[model samples]
Target: MASKANKELESWIKHLSGEDMPVFSGTVADVTESVNSEDSSASEVAQTILRDASLTSRLLKVANSFNYNPGGKKISTVSRAVMVLGFEQVGALTLTLALVDSLSEGVQRHKLTEEMAQSFHAAIQAQQLAKKMGCKSPEDIFVATLLSRLGNMAFWAFSGQKGTEVLNLIQSENLTEQEAELQVLGFRLRDLTVGLSKSWSLGELLDDFLSDHHGNDERHNIISIGQELAEAAKNGWDSEQVAIIFEQAAKKLGLSVDEVEELAHQNAKHAKEITRIYGVTDASKRIPQPNIDMGLIEEDVDEAKSDSTDEPRLTITEDTSTAVTSKYPEPDSNVQLTIMQEITSAIEEKPSINIILEMVLEGLHRGVGMDRALFAILSPDRRTLTCKYAIGEDNERLCKELRINLSNTNNIFHQVIDSKKAMHVPSDPKKLTGTLSRDTLTLLGPPAYLVMPVIVRSKVIGIFMADRNASGRDIEEKDFIAFQQFCQQANMGLTFLAM
Candidate 1:
């Protein structure tokens, strides 16, 4: 019943179904050679690769469909591709396409079933979704989508007749392929895809999408939109219905549906064409142009399908406060996650360690309603904590040269250093000596204050001191504990940096 061309195509592709197909060398070599090129001509060389008619065409189709190439005249030259994508980037892109081609070779293709056409359609739709969403790197969307369904391909290749049965049920049943997969293979296609992605060492983002795409993660959502478009192709869904589904999906994935519709449509068309150029087909039945609403319902249905396999939830016995307790008893998971986030955020915003101290000083000054805040770190010699950053008093810099002896009997710094832990000083500055003991407070200066040592790697590294307004009141127990927690977090951050 099938055409001879289709039968031959299936046989050749089935040869690829072997689990032991040698890693496609041409693709890897192309990427390696590109990377190894002399720096001076890297750009030119990369341009040449993009300029190849076949490669250029593929790239354009991918870019346009992925929704990444800013709309203009269709890109026809490698020079333009190089300029738009850059040299290093062009290498990355070439590598991606090369990988896709190599992997798809041995994949089984039932020629008459139009499987290859559907694959191209899905890939192009994914790229368009990326562009429409204004994704910074829509090329990635193309790559992710192109590779997303490889798991299903490999399943068919290896399982042979059994795989065909699964595919048959998927096309016949209105249920998801994942459900049919469970019936036929006892595991999900996603599990296979993730395994292959890991084995191939694909980029982290792609790996994330492959593993997490069906879930609430955005990349997953984008790929889902691609699949939805592919489904639309089969169902003969009208543009309006497609737009509604697209808009709903875009909102869920934080994309603008109205703005991306043209892009999505273009991408879907391109992916369909590209996959057709190859030899893949969709196993799902095409829905004819169906009318659909665009809104919360779409999101709910999609998300529900994604999370359906999750295990049942059990009651949590721990209270919220106690749940924050450290998983790592010594290092403290709660403290680490908190401090790491703060330090990473601060560094991400402003790339300086001094900025961290400034942040601490500002928080203490305002958050505690303090008149002044001082942050001092011990010199490498361990003699004193030099005032690195401060807020409040104008003479804070004048006190920059200040140091408290680590071994001095009257020094509170010595007590904290000796203990190798936090020591809180409340309302009793007179008990301390030297600069710390300075009772300018007795002269009606800033009244209540607290000082805690910054310990890192079992050694006292710095000291943080905060002075309250001239109210002469004692610090509250809760406030002291909060301050202690803050110091602990700071200590953990500093320790991590030291490592």
Candidate 2:
């Protein structure tokens, strides 16, 4: 009986899939899927989002919103918008708008309105509070806090259960909101939200907010305070619940209660301004101002969850200076994936050194779509790496003669072998003078290339090198990931062949 009950609860979570939601249009879905992919690019995702004219306008409006665009520079295109707002943020915002549109419909209209209003109001509060705290990724916190309640709000909007009954059960039975949810709907709203958040690949930060709730952490406190304050605002500012929440928040923020009050009002003002952008259509039904109805007591915010305030920023580095200096264009992703598949299949059926080496070179050339690729075997004594297989040059004869000594050198190729990590070398020798030697540059056919070491159980065995050569095509993060995965797979095949 217990097992059957558990499955029933899990079913509710399964129903909360992003696919079933009305907001997940194919374009929005594509951006989510693409940005989450290891081989996809911001520019590539931007291209897909651009296909939807309405979505493009929405993205630009938010990107050029007073917050993201401070320089007054006009973001004229979707591609530029994606760059400005960040691909992940753009994707999250797309989902946020769509989700509100879906959940704001149907029977639980009043209840749904309350939840959405609280979520948006709290999100803006968390964002402003986070900024004041010197948090690096305030935007991340804003999105996470807003989405934290997505599961509960979604459930309330969908479950057809009376909100009053759920609330009464929690109070009368002394059951937690999640406990009441399990008894009523067979699953926690958090279960639905966390599951869908991961499926949509919202960001790891949201995952942390949902999963990590260690007490005394500023991030969790910020989320908690945001929720509490939303309820306080709903009840009117001078209510007992609001006073308690403010007292607690004041302690965490190390501010006077008066100061906290000021910030809360300011946050309310901003929230009112951002309702349209955040998909809250009716601004008139805003958070009940503390000033307007002082001491009017209301119930606590229901089934709301916490999110993190700390920022984890990941930088996607592109060589801004080298685009003009490099001569070759980046490899196409489809071609790269196809080539990698072919290499994997060829090596699996025929694990011979020659066959594997040939396929690898072919991948680097035709698969990676690079101009040249070479396979060099490491000597038994680790004395040298000598080019034994080559492709993509007018003379494969000279390509075969290229060699590099194992002696200590500042060049990237040497670093790849020493560090056992693939290294990216773009055009512009002067920029990389700390590593690449003039002689090494002379040997490489292209100004840009990647050198990855092939290893077998930690022992360096051989080298895979390729470049656009004189064309100087700079590698991107996605391209680098593809190249690295190829190297790892090739290493396995080479290891088997060597045995």
Candidate 3:
């Protein structure tokens, strides 16, 4: 039996990682690796997300949603989203959105929808319970709970003959879910979830909860209650089973039974809206509506619509359909303006220099349509420059390779800093032959690029560099103007901090 189970698990894993959902598998792997690495910065994570324009837009929307951004602050860029929502929160949201995008369109979509709805419902329930218990990170609990049933969701999404057989066994024999999975697939779906969690490095909390479903830890107990409530609520919020789960949660959370009941009801409604925000509208519709007052639900819906309208919409010069299908990003004036405003707000609020740099880099990459953008800070000794934050293609490699020796006054980068002026390198290779060194050319490629000094209080503190090499597009006059403007904003922000 053990051998059979191992083989079955491996087979299912192979199937899921194969052609069925390659994009999702790749996303999970990329995001997990980036988020889990000790050296990974928020900029790195943002770059990972920004590679997919659709994912980027969806993540920003979720970050700006009421549940995530209660303060009503608009998140225009993925960099700001990472800063505002937190690194783990943004990573979790990316994984969630990727999962929905990958699995929402496959075969047995109805079953997938049920799994997605259940996960969302349980996630919200767990998050609410975590908040009530005063846990340090409710978002962690939410993500852990949502992905707890990964095997079940993935199975329904990509499984073929074996899946139908398992379903048939459950229906015909009246067996429980695990028994059906075990009889047909040689292992339980829960075991598969544990396997996938490990392989994907989803998180320690998820692995721990899957390993000990009935653990004594308070956080784990909350997760268990959340999943149970989601399952029981399928029968109805007022069902006896739900009542029992609520009673247990009330005791665990040190809350009255009435309070637990109310929280559960509110979370159910919240889960519905959150699922919709995630672009899984089908799953959102499948989520059971709590037996709450109709008037209150209507009021909530109206408020959500109003809040959405207030969000700054992206405005592209090209037609909407063409822009969506275009391979390269077009300059978005709306996003550029919004990010500029955010930078001003960050300066007023006394944010970290890293935050200011990140926003500027985002402005150059996404707003100004640069194929690659980076911020390189001068070493304290003032002898060398090193990349601190970067975005766009091959950013990780760019970060490591982007170094300039300040003593080389002949270099264009050094000249920019010395003069405290912005320079736009034309695409003509002849113009860069002497001024641009061979090492710089190898690192940045031979393309039109922009370099500007970030001056604070009349001192050149750093430099901003951007290029259109990835897209092989020539640096336009407007791009240079926008790049200079963003660098100026960064200088102003740093000056404010110095004050």
Candidate 4:
């Protein structure tokens, strides 16, 4: 029976391979172009936004959220919304809007449980910790807490009916959701999110925040605080263990125990606010979407039609609407030699990844107007992809929440991991239609994306991603060559870091 189940799983995976992969939108590309343009004025930014009605509306809605104003007077214009939020918040809101818009509308179910309420409570607890630690923006704490366990949402989105089975295994069998997902699906949602975030150009700050599982730094420590609180509050971890993690974290972050307690109280207060916004109920049986029921599944297969320009027939799969299975250009010896010379010379110098990633990402932003670029290192176990460095602007908190479990099926990161190769998708809206499922698309944000695996010897060591503007432009040969060179240098740098 076990062997039969394995065969069926393999067959399903193979069938999925033949189907088209999902594609992300060029939202991040837009953010990139707007920020990097010659003028880069508020007017240019507003003009750029005028083109996308979705971003306009999302900006307004988030502006209306309690963070913006204590009172609610609906301001009706994008410019007005921008005025209210300032440029930084406006940019963040735009990314957030694009992300929410791209989520899948597929049939899946999420059961809101007492534990769900408890999770919110934990998020608030984390916020309190941030405040106690003197984080100026407690709201950053709120956002961090809100999204730390978003992998839970990803699981519910992908698992369909067996979400419960997967959740049960996590709880009863003492497994992380990513581990269980590997047993069931070959990849976990975390894997999908990291690749998707890079592809969509969600920005480096968010990329780093989302994938920073290590809670060592000040920024990452907040997310670690939140995760610990959430696990304690929802999972019923022993109070002593929770206190230990908290005390140790607080000491590292330079906060007192009294301060941590006050933060926990704030968490309790904010839990109500989260509940009100999402309309989650303690006893709710289903997450907002329906469970996957193939019995009720509708196939919307378009007749195999050739592209107008005679490229490959890009099938729009339930996962994505874009065709992005192209190979990356090989490294250019000229560029590689220069970059490698710089890297080798700098090894003893110990350059920051920020400086290095910026040189690479900034070049892409200049060459093709990519918004941002990021890189991740696969864990020694190869089960997790943790963001190591990023370039571009956004909140550091979001990066802290980012992590990719290698088992997630919904993301292109896993594809890069498995194939140990490069993945690129063009930004033509026509081509992007079914290349990415809505949710993965939304989470990642920018549509036009490329993922390149960094291999040393035969072993896969890391992955690099670059994203273009909302235009979702295809990576030209020159750009691909530069990317390969960048990867080669980056791999060497990381190797040095390890040594």
> C-alpha displacement of 427 in model 2, angstroms?
40
Where does candidate 1 stray beyond 4 Å?
Answer: 1-108, 111-116, 157-159, 167-176, 213-220, 239-244, 253-261, 272-499
> Which structure is stronger by TM-score: 1 or 4?
4
Clashing pairs for predicted structure model 3, backbone only: none
Task: Give the per-residue lDDT of model 3 (tens digit) for 1-499.
Answer: 7997899898887777786667777887787777778987777788778888777777777788898999998888777787777887898899888877667544555566678889999999999889888998788788899999988988887777787788788889999889988888899888888888887777888888988855567889888888999888777676799889888888888899999998888889899988887777766766677765445534544554354335312111112331344445678777789989988877787877888898899888888988888989898887788988888888888787878777777877788887888888778767773377677778888868899998989998889999888888777888899989999989988988988
Candidate 3, residue 187: how far the Cα is off, in Å? 1.8
Q: Which stretches of candidate 4 lie over 4 Å from their true place?
A: 1-25, 32-39, 43-58, 71-74, 97-106, 111-152, 161-176, 206-216, 235-241, 278-499
The candidate scoring highest on TM-score is: 3
C-alpha positional error of residue 207 in candidate 1 after TM-score superposition, expressed in Å: 1.4
lDDT of candidate 2 over 1-499, digit per residue (tens): 5676557646655665543463553444566566678865443465454333344445556666676677766554443345456666676666665665566543454456567778888888888888888877776678778888877677667756445677779879999887887777666777777776776666676777788654566776787778778867776766788888878889999889888888988898788667655535542244666466433323222211111112111111222322222222246565467556656655566634665565555555544656667778888887677876665553244344567776766656677788898877666667563365455556775456777998887798888887765444556666667777778888887777667
lDDT of 2 at 143: 76
The TM-score measured for candidate 2 stands at 0.52
Residue ranges of candidate 3 with Cα displaced over 4 Å: 21-41, 172-175, 213-215, 292-327
Q: Residue 424 error for model 4, in Å?
A: 46
Candidate order (lDDT):
3, 2, 1, 4
Better of 1 and 2 by TM-score: 2
Cα-lDDT of candidate 3 = 0.80
Error of 3 at 142 (Å): 0.5
